[model samples]
Target chain A: MKPHWLVRPGSIRLLWIVFLCILALTVLAGLLVHPHAAFGIDGSFGFYTWFGFASCIALIIVAKLLALLLKRKDTYYDGD
Target chain B: MTAISLIPPGLPLVLGALLLPLCTARLRALLVLGLPLLVLALVWQLPAGAVLSIDFLGHELAPLSDSKLARLFATVFAIMAFAGGLFGLNHMRVAELSAAMISAGSAIGIAFAGDLVTLLVFWEALALASTLLVWSTRTPQSRDAGLRYLVLHLFGGVLLLAGIIGQVAATGSVAFTAMALDSPAQWLILAGFLINAGAPPLSAWLPDAYPEASPGGMVALSAFTTKAAVFVLLTGFPGADILIAFGLYMVFYGIVYALLENDMRRILAYSIINQVGFMIVGIGIGTEMALNGAAAHAFTHIIYKALLLMSAGSVLYMTGKRKCTDLGGLFQSMPLTAICGIIGALAISSFPLTSGFISKSMISQSAADQHLTFVWFMLVAASAGVFLHAGIKFPWFVFFQKDSGLRPPDPPLNMRLGMILFAFLCIALGAWPAPLYNLLPYPVDYAPYTYAHVISMLQLLLFSGLAFFIMLPYLKRTLTITLDWDWFYRRLLPRAACPLVRALDAWQRRCSIDTLRHISHFLGALFLYHGPQGVLARTWATGSMVLWVVILLGIYLLAYYF
Candidate 1:
């Protein structure tokens, strides 16, 4: 079987490292500057970072559930 | 010059659109590009006041009025026209070009409208022109979609006109001005405006129809109608509290729907609602900064959204496909298109150093400034959701997912140029928003690039991206479409039609034929019993004659006895 560069083991590890670095830096960036919190807790370090992550996960889960209920064949209306 | 001598600023484009079809192809192309520039110049030169009025059927009509808000909307609209004209230069037919121009002109007409009557005229004109643009795609889907689009918009126009008539009748005036939700008429006006702004539960018209246009046609389609509605809302009902609720619903609604969409353009269509949702929220907040944000965001949004759609349009043009399920890894071949699409995606997500960043933050700032904590949090959440749905999902699925093994190159030169121009504007506006800020309806008092603000925005977006990566398996593309409000119209309504019609038909026949049958039965009985029957007519007459003489004598005797 042929191997793709992106899926190579070393490449996969590097990608993970890069992702973690970004996630960590984003969390750390909050320490450098304080947000004028709109809410009481939003002023905390990494507050938005965590909120953004949690909300996205929650939204995707809800969307997946919606997809379960509402999805039909792309040809649903086209009468295929 | 006196008002009598002045011309309405949008007339040249409107008239030129009529003349466009008569010319040769090249000449039509030249006129298409030249007409918008002319309109822009005319819009710029007009002073900020009601400059032209004429007597019309015993009422004064101001066809041209200029204010900071109106001019702001007019400027971006004209720029959009020019960019759209350029993009469609080689691809579109003469009819499409003319329709686009007329729509563009009417949008500007909406901006300059000084009175409700003139505004209604132009509002309906926009509907007519845009519907033509949709139909010019000349596909079956385009035809059906265009019809639906027309029906919905015309219904909205009726609401608007009804409201205008009621308001004018009650006030004994025709002027357009800021209004509150004090009357049913004003609420109707808001509904009319909200429909165009893609506010739900009527927003399905946008995603349902817009994706069916020709690639270049969609470019023009992306700009005018919704933004013009936003323009009117900004003019008419800036501080309506109910809009805040509607706007929040629309924001999340767009994200959820887009997440479930398989078609690339449909995803963007949902995002248009999302973007307009931000503007609507800003208008709802109705602070100075919020109004400015709404106006500024509208300007930047036209550019980036057009850019995004242009990229999607280019993909559809180069390859005869629009569904994300059928596209992937074209970025290897279509580098320019991919990069521009990414820029648009970033801009739309309000990433720092993009137009969306500079413009959209003001709305959230206002929410925070007013200490509407929940609204502020939701706006921030929506911003992150924007990144998840559009910023990464769009480009990632279309350009970088599992390779579909289809390697289509970039679109034609004019399209690339249009995308490049808007992409440049997206970055330029984000980097230096002074020019756009200067053009806003309010004073330029806010800055978008404070350190903490940029950091927080980045944190929200990057973490959202991280979440997207985490959820990659669940987000896989499939050949499925999620049901929306259109289900009522597209599925349920048509299915219900047959029984409804049969019931109505039965009632009609019962009323007419049943009554007729009963009348006929009565007439037949009357004829058989009394009319010209031989036995009764012949013998009875002779017997009665003889009896009558004897009866007369008897009656005389009886009368004497009595």
Candidate 2:
């Protein structure tokens, strides 16, 4: 039997394959569930889905940027 | 006359608090506990519709009643006071304990208030007492937080007073009744109530101030203010449409910020906003089932939130640390607290056998029945988020993360006992919801334990758990403040005001120095010019007068000739 690749440093290339697998799984699940019946493309359903996903990504990006700017040493509150 | 005492039930707690400073620390603590117990006994003995009336400042006030809604809130408040007193016994500062008692009693007064005047009075009293609790910490940060808290609450009080005056002017009645949203007066009252509920734009105040309080102080602070506001909204503005949107926003705001928060106590504080969001949504739906859900949720939430805060308070007490980064593997030493905290976490997440599931499900059911499929879906997603942020993230990060190797002993016996009592209540209520439902303003017809419902909830929450572990890299803790609506005051206003204040100070200093220099120079010149032997000062008063008169006479003669 072949060993699972994630256990070894030599298998770093497997990480991308894992990522793609998850993405494909998500898309397949979406198609199978047929969320279009509940959320049509033309209506607010699409907007909310896109907006929610976009905002989540944007928030993560903004959080990272703010962390760079405003991050403090853990002992900052201790002095006061 | 078979007459019930007309004095307000909450008055003795206030009076006792005033006298508490005179007592020894031991006696003061006893009185703090005893006063609320006595009030609870009084509340129980009073018959339904028992009325109390008094006139103060030309306003008639009545704060006695024993209606189901009043009984429900009052009962829990008394319980909270007792539990809070037990928890606070070791840290017995007379001022804080007394203030907490007064805060609890005032909430009780609002619960039993028969008129708007009485309710408004007690509402303001709640503000004063709770602010005193914050200020009693005697730290600069706590003082600042307390001041900001006072400003927000006082503004809310003014809105309430204005609304009451308008209602009195319009209807010529001071009696408290369910208000329709059509009138401006009623809408004002709703705004006032919503403000205290920690509704949006201003909702940041709860998380901002509460986490800044002393460890014991947060336990007391958790129980009263927001729940009292929920009680008022339930009574006053039952079916407002705007509340639905506000609730949804608060729910998301709580999750987003809680997800970003690093401080353990602050995370719990944000979770309070999230849980209250459910109640507010229930209140907005305003069906029998929804109101019942709200009332029951309030009962359950108070216990679980207090339990959560108590656990966090214990951790703070033991380690003197509050941030998630500073705490981990604490459960190894404090196993009991960890277990109790996890109980609270599960209950809050509405796991099938916990209080939240039985109570919060009704609200969502009502939304679905109302054909609010989108709202229901959003709430379902939020439920998943709740598990991600609070239900699991809290305990996992604080108790089971990469071990920080800091183990403090279990908290004091009284604190443990308090946590146990509340934990027991959480489980008991979840197992047997009938008692809670019977106390609701409406009948409970909806069932919470359905096979499909349980399965879906588990799938959603469990998957969210999977997401949390998977996304742990993104969820790493950092030492930075997440700016909220509070940035309007904490950062923006202060930053904006500093320059203006500096300019004003500079201008004032310059003006003062310039004015002093000019005055001194003028005084010196006057001394030089008018002294003997100086330029205009000689012994010539009489000569000058004669010259002036002669000049005037010559001018008059010339004018007459012309």
Candidate 3:
């Protein structure tokens, strides 16, 4: 018996390639559309792309830091 | 008046719940499925005004009314009841089905309540019913969690009651309408509504209690309370500026905490606050479009979030595992569940041609329309964060992470049917949003599928997806929980009480000791004056008594003569 193709490492690599291409196309699409901006600097090219990426990165960083202070065993409240 | 015309919109469902516990399994199933559909039909058929009103407490009380907005919320609530009933039809506990019906009915009642008193009555009913739903799980954690959930909701209810009293006193009106925020009454009302909406500082109650429910119960618990709060806020305090800040805090709080969470259900719970945050912000924005967006998002969010939870619940039902660390690669055996979960994930992420895209974009568009530059950007970023935490993270970790070797099949037919129903709705409402748009309180003026909008939203979301995978190492789940504001009552308050209790014990002991000494001193004085060896207690007592009487008589005679 063989494993499913989608979960295979080779197929996973190919899927990654396809996904990256789609990402590139979306950025290209961003370049193509002239969004009617209502705010300063949001009208710039690939603004949502960069801002979305940057915001998520910042969110993960802050969360990781907060975890250092706040994280506890899943049983934290169980004993109480 | 007909039976329904005399009673409120959701009374039948609540009444039907009473029959559930008494009925046979066949009758119970019938009541579960039939009651909500009956309510749904009745909701749409009602005329748009108060059909039931009476004089109560010297004011007109409209317990049942109909309007486009009310119909919108009631329609979704009824649909949710039907779907939840279908999913939980075989739930081990009959009590849960009963509580679900009551809460679902009260939510519809809230949608139609035209006066503060009527709303308050149904609101408290919702709190108790929801608490029952939590307790129905019959686990120790659920017992304690239900207590916390009940306490917070009761506090919210008290605030709401006090505010209603003050508002009625000050204005002598009970109409449930938009209110100014100038008075303390309005602030109290806003606080109560905010607490239920899962706004920050008090928002910890949501994730802490929600994930403690049964798989079936969680699906039912997810829809009513918070959305009803959004409904009230949408009706009661639109255009309140503070909600914008509250909404934004919930938005990010959900993301960061969910990103740190390991339990799959808890992730969805945190994201509930996040999803509701978007609606709260729209309500805060308070334009016609934004109000519509908030309402539409509530409608769409209920379905999709239910869909997500249904699938998650299905997995839990089959495998008895909920943590991402313990779940993975079940897509191998449960492809239907995986596909449905992914659809829900996409809908929640507002992927183009999904329900979220149509409904949530309107909220962001409204912010842009108002030229709220900072808000607009934050909403855009939060939209992306929605993708990170709920959209990709949930599906990736649960379905595609390293295989946990669980081979549970998709849940039974009823659960699948429930999930499919909502999944179809998520796409149907998005692919053709006209039906949903027509139900909004305001006229639809925005197009969701414009080329630029789709492209930019895709750019934002795809990049967010990229960011997620890039940061996947940090997002990995562990057997740890992140503390939130509930930590105050859950850990700190209990720990802080120990010392306070000891100090009070010491104070009471010292006081008792001092009182004992004082009693001994008083006893010694009594002994000195009147004990056996004392002069007054000896044989001279009679003689002294006679002498004193003689002296008293002589004094009286002398005074009289004078």
Could you say which candidate leads in lDDT?
A: 3
CA lDDT of B271 in candidate 1? 93
Candidate 3's C-alpha runs over 4 A off are B1-6, B499-562
Clashing residue pairs in candidate 2 (N, C-alpha, C atoms within 3 angstroms): none
Q: Give the distance in Å from residue B238's predicted Cα in candidate 3 to where it truly belongs.
A: 1.0
Worst 10 residues of 1 chain B by lDDT: B1-10
**Per-residue CA lDDT of candidate 2, range B1-562, in tens?**
3354555668788888889889987787688778878888877777667877777667676767557888889888888888888888887477888888888889989998888988988999999988988888788888888899999999889998899889988988888878888888888888889888889888877987888777778888888999999898888878777888888888777777787789999999998998888889988888888888888888889889899889999999899899998898788789889989999999998988889889888888788777677777677667777887788889988987767878699999988988999999889998888888887887778777755555445555555665666677888987756766776777678779999999999889878869788788888889798767776777768888899899999999999988
For residues B242-265, write the lDDT of model 3, one tens digit per residue: 888888888889999999999999
List clashing residue pairs in candidate 3.
none
Better of 1 and 2 by lDDT: 1
TM-score per model over all chains: 0.92, 0.84, 0.93
DockQ of each: 0.66, 0.09, 0.87
Best model number under TM-score: 3
Which segments of candidate 2 are over 4 A away from where they belong?
A1-80, B1-7, B23-32, B499-550
Chain B TM-scores of the candidates? 0.92, 0.92, 0.93
- Which 10-residue span in candidate 2 chain B carries the lowest summed lDDT? B451-460
Candidate 1 lDDT tens digits, A29-78: 77988556667798987888889999899889888998889999888888
Q: Rate the local accuracy (lDDT) of all candidates.
A: 0.88, 0.80, 0.91
